[model samples]
Target: MTSFLDEFAQAPNLKYLNHAAVSPWPKRAALAASRFAEQNVLLGARDYPEWMGVEQRLRERLMRLLNAPSTDDIALVKNTSEALSFVAFGLDWQAGDQVIISDEEFPSNRVVWEALQPRGVEVIQVNLKGMDPESALLAACGPRTRLLSISSVQYVSGLRLDIERLGEGLRQRDVLFCVDAIQQLGALPFDAIAAQCDFAMADGHKWLLGPEGLGVFYCRAELREQLKLQEYGWHMLEHMGDYSRIEWQPARSARRFECGSPNMLGTMALEASLSLLEEVGMATVGKLIEERVLWLQEGLERLPGIQLHSPMNPARRAGIITFSLEGHDNQVVFDRLKAEQVVCVQRGGGIRLSPHFYTAPKVIEETLAVLHGLAG
Candidate 1:
């Protein structure tokens, strides 16, 4: 029997610790894409109904992954930005309405709300550097605060917030909550319903172990029709298959967000990738990821002049661990690591290393050894 680790066949000398940015697909995902390409060449859409079944399975998997209410809440989006745009532009905003976000958000999360400035909607940036980041965010909400959009885990610092707590607080305040869950969804166990997020989105290329250009968007069932439709096509219509119908409405489900054709190629790869995650179970996956992150943290802490940037508390961490050498430029350190085939990135004034659940012990050991040499 082959081990689950065997699913990943990375190069012998390549130490890939960049799952936070992009993940190499599992063998199953590759094979699924290959089979899809072969089928396309052999018979052009002859089995398109079977392809649609694969897409449905993908939605079901994503629904389970997010702990969403139902598959009705899941939307297959092009990327995280598109989903964010749907919320940003779809909302009914008024002058003086404000959206609260952290200062450390990725561009997708920040820029979307800022674009609403033209409509007199204010974007408030709260600093998450304080001891109680959740408290800071909650306090920032006032009468004018319309929504609170946050990342489940900070991308650069790997600071995992207590989203359940925030969710409860937002509910009491009657404020809508949106979470950019790209950094946490696959790396940890994410519960959309428990978190009480009105909206959430994440890309498949990162910790999901799939290709880019495809992602999951979850909208609360109650708010399905509340969001105004910004895009329209045959796929998003209520009478989707009835092309002869003169009048139609947007889908009653979250499928309303999906306009035009689905990315069948991406659907094939992501569904197969998600199957591996399901087989492993997210609880086990999250536990193993934590173990790897903690192991990396311990090794980095032992290095001379190492400065840790990610959260030290285990409860406040996800899969990311970032650090910097005391006297080395971040870019220089990143360049050195890149040249050594120790794949990683520089972020938050430090080097960011993200290891997934199946990262080999050898990869971790050798990466530490290389860092030890650099420290010396």
Candidate 2:
């Protein structure tokens, strides 16, 4: 519907292009969160059942978003790091087992693997600067390699990997695959099933256009129980409501990973945000985002002393476009943009501009005009 595009009622002077970091929620999500707060203040937990319904819908939306087999494969976690820890600490690791990853991964992806070093598990950082990144990553999967962990799109450089290629290559080597999908999940179309990922996780606050502190984690069904439970509570019990029962086991579904009460406030907002994305359809969303990214790419390339750090190939990126001006320091440029009310971030040794599907053309034009002035 045409009305869906109007959901974002941002400031007229604001040129926000920082979805790769934290995004401002649309009007609908803000309203949903407001209404939820009112209900809590007036009625307390009296309508808790209805709140649970919203949570369920959130899981379903995430299930469809990830192309997961079922809602049973999805777990609402605190953030990407928590879900990564579930897989990092859950798996049984042996001495000399290697975990291969890219050299450009965010600290969240890299530090987790490196932590396993004390257990005699080596973390091999593979350079993806070569022509064929997938081949370089797979070549590192020697006989002792047990898993391959990578980000769907590198956060800083905005280099999108061929997940299908990596998935197939890892599968052939009998290696488990884990994807940190925070950068790609909401910017473009992603498939956990197609990628054959044993585990995948993403936070809601970034390109999902939702609030912080809530995220989704997907684990393949066959490997569900294989992950040893590190946390336990009433919520994760198979019989969650049996208050008087002593005997309990983890839920047979992915709910086993949820250790405590849900973040109901975050649930309401993210669910509403997801509804908007569903209405637009991810295919259309991806196309619109690519158009915007390409526009930024072209505009920045034409500016004097501009150099792009992100991939120039259309097929090799998502919504992010990182670039630098020859005469300007990254922090100084970032401060100038911030003072001008052009919301963007300095990352990957440059300024990272990420515009979403609903970003107005005027925003891009005006933001580029600012950069044009700075370039002069």
Candidate 3:
């Protein structure tokens, strides 16, 4: 087993702090992908059964990561958007039915619900700037609100919401809870069951440390059959491999959402990436991420002309920290950082810095140094 620190062997000069956008694969993930490619080149599909085993392990990992009730609740989807679509289009909606979301949501979380406009479904955007965002969201939920779909953490502001609170609130009101957990799933500990979330989805590319094309969708066991399936194929059938079956039904699990063939290459990479997270344990992974974000936050505050855009309270944030130098244009500052090999991004009208658990202290120190120079 490789030491966790050695798993991320990024280039010496590259100070990467953009885990919110996309993540560099850990060494093990790359090696797994490479081995899968080599196997295809040598053996074709002769070892396909073993590949299915890898896929099963991936599902089990995702199940445990989300603290879901069972692997039966997990579905491998193309991405977060695809999974959100499943929820958006699957549910029975009436005209004037409402779906509540935060004003700070990434477009994926907002647009899918908004697309239901044609169905006469009203989408409410609640302001999360208040001291208690959860309270604001609950206050916005009226008798007409059918569901509350929100990101577990705001993409640009890095505002982490109390999902459990929202879950409890929604439960009393009988409103469905859907979480766009892309920014929170792998960076922090998540519990689908504890949160009582009806549906949740996340991509593997960011904090999950995997490829782009694969993601996980978790549907509560009771809600599985309630969602109308939009896509169909042999693979999603209850008797999937029995091609001779004249009649069939969708699988009695969350696998019903998967339309066709799976992304085996992505499966191998993500399974391997998740192995690292499991090895380190989410409690430690989340602790390390928060510590790094706080480190960056404190360091940014000490720099001259710095104005922070992300939440200052550690409880209100995750791994993201967005700030700006008063004297510097965001693009100009971004370019300077890019030239200096300080990889970050401009978002929410400021520069966004996102670090993973494995990010070294020097990376944060050096990034702050670059910002300090820009501040001057």
Task: Give me the runs in candidate 1 sitting further than 4 Å from their true place.
Answer: none
The local distance difference test score of each candidate is 0.94, 0.94, 0.94
Measured with C-alpha atoms, the lDDT of residue 57 in candidate 1 is: 98
C-alpha positional error of residue 166 in candidate 2 after TM-score superposition, expressed in Å: 0.9
lDDT of 2 by residue, 126-185 (tens): 999998999999999999999999999999988999998999999999999999999999
RMSD of each: 0.9, 0.9, 1.0
Q: For residues 171-283, write the lDDT of model 1, one tens digit per residue.
A: 99999999999999888999998899999999999999999999999999988788999998999998899999999988999999998999999999999999999999999
The all-Cα superposition gives candidate 3 an RMSD in Å to the true structure of 1.0
Clashes in model 2: which pairs? none
What 10-residue stretch in candidate 3 is worst by lDDT?
1-10
Q: Total clashing residue pairs per candidate?
A: 0, 0, 0
lDDT of 3 at 236: 92
